[model samples]
Target: MPAEQQHCSEKSAVTNSSTHLPVRAEWLATHSEMALDPALPVIDSHHHLYDRPGSRYLFDDLLCDIRDGHNVRATVIVQARSMLRADVPAHLQPLGETEFANGVAAMSASGIYGDARVCAGIVGFADLTLGDAIRPVLERHISLAGGPIDTGGRFRGVRQSLTWDADASLTNPLYPTTQSMMDEPLFRRGFAHLAPLGLSFEAWVFFHQLSRVAGLARAFPQTQIVLNHCGGVLGIAAYANRQAEVFTHWKLGLQELADCPNVMVKLSGLGMRLGGFAFSDRERAPSSDELADAWRPWIDTCIDTFGPDRCMYGSNFPVDKGSYGYGIGLNALKRLTAEYSRDDRANIFWRSAQTFYRLPESSMVMSSSNR
Candidate 1:
């Protein structure tokens, strides 16, 4: 194993010695509240499926959240290095994740997990440094995802995240700082292959790197780019006391990014540890109203810049579950966008993701329209 992966494995073993802390049913039950606008359709645009030593969130965990009274009809699975075949070559390891996700999709399709279609879209990782040679890897993923088959084919995009920082404490050591992965000639060459394959690109860079995303969008105007975690606004470590400065910088960068018509923003991940929400430190989890108040400025700025059509709400679950329950996390999104028109709300909750991922039209319909 690489030093980073080995280190992470060792750390996870240590952490698992205690207990997995997230998705605690008891803690979430304390904040029991009815689903906000239960009729609203939702397609959780970004989430993960991982079974680490300390934390294991897979099909059952996802089903628990989906059945929490919200109308989550489908979901998009983001890559998280789970279920990778250890026997495979380094480049081919990501296929195992897609295969794992496809199995989850198959399970959800059996109607055993209620109406929510988990892993309706699969966003796996590929080393874009391979440049054009990455095509074969992508084709392998598509073929394994069932190609054009209706029941299992849901390979949507690639998410080779560039979420690195020089401050070691602020970033994952596995993704060491690259300074400019997005601007690299080799990376661009690999990224250029997506549009032709009808695949989108999920950019998971931090706030300081938004300029690189902007440049990428401008360069690949035909390709669809989804900005993960609202440009991954960092509020931890060196950024902890610099909220004001970060906001100003993030806002300006967002405005520049929005100038690219093909790019969309995911309104989620605010509850993450790196986001600096501090909700988990409280005596009790925050209510929807409190979360809405805390997140309004950033969410409003995204909506104002990208409009409802380009802004979709993602749960970023299991990751966000570290701080808040799935119910509370999604309810916060509901509370945040309550002031928008019904159509706009629909766009954020589901339509934007549906269109962006090109998911099945039949599966995207709202279960109940009486709200």
Candidate 2:
């Protein structure tokens, strides 16, 4: 067996007992069956890596999930401020995240973790509010990501999250209470710098803010922008009891955003706390079928509007782990897309991510006919 497989088997006997704040291994173990269509290739378009006070999901944790029965051939590491360097200047702190992700990519490439190349694309954080000043930071990320010890050329994009709300409980304390980032002149100026450097922008905003992202996409048609978490649909706290009202507005916003061809949507994050699914509060985990049924409307809307080529599946893992296991999460996606044509399903699973991130063609698991 491969070294990674051997290691996984040894640890399989030992259940995770860590009392992490958001993700409990005991809870995830409540449902253990692998999903249907396990052979479908996936790129896991969005996930995070962190080692924090109440939570810690490192390389091993990620690999364990990848080995949990899906053909996850690659992954894109989204930023969560996990490993920023405290020694660096405030703005330069994000470079350390890229460096750390590239190191993880290097480890995955060693073949010890099977063929799935985790962090095949690294999307680190950068404050685009810096305007023109953000250029050097972008260069630094590019340089470090392409350095000798890093992944050869997997650094793809930057994500300056604008996920916020007026309700204090719903918003991340670290983020400013801004109404719209796209309207900021300084932010727009900084966003313009991305296209010239061949970097894509990963935009994370609430469903209400979809029009803002649509405006940004229209303003900078040259830049490729990815809409993270199905445009960050909220169903928690203030928005909890009004699911019907929220969905009506959310669908309208999504339709407007879909008019912008430069944008793509990541079809995941349905299990997030912000969505108010409350999957974590259940006595036992829901099955893949249950997950598929609940997420179908939103997922189908994105696929129908964006088309399969512009819609890709994402795990949003460790965060999504708060509600469901990695296998069940992905299995739910498989069940959701079961009716689509083979090519459409392939696009949702892996091809869209490969094209959007500009991941190397050699890393792709294309069929002999395509070759």
> Of the candidates shown, which would achieve the greatest TM-score relative to the real structure?
2
lDDT of 1 by residue, 23-121 (tens): 443344445556889878889999888888757777876766666678888899999888888887998998999999988888887777677888888
- TM-score of every candidate: 0.91, 0.92
CA lDDT of each candidate? Answer: 0.81, 0.82
Clashing pairs in 1: none
Q: Which candidate achieves the best lDDT against the true structure?
A: 2
lDDT for each residue of candidate 2 in 167-196, tens digit (9 for 90 to 100): 766666665648867789999999988998
Q: Kindly give the stretch of ten consecutive residues in candidate 1 with the minimal lDDT sum.
A: 11-20
lDDT for model 1, on a 0 to 1 scale? 0.81
Model 1 off-target regions past 4 Å?
A: 1-26, 149-152, 365-371
Root-mean-square deviation per candidate: 6.3, 3.8
How far is 2's C-alpha from truth in model 1 (Å)?
44
Model 1 TM-score is 0.91
**Model 2 accuracy (lDDT, Cα):** 0.82
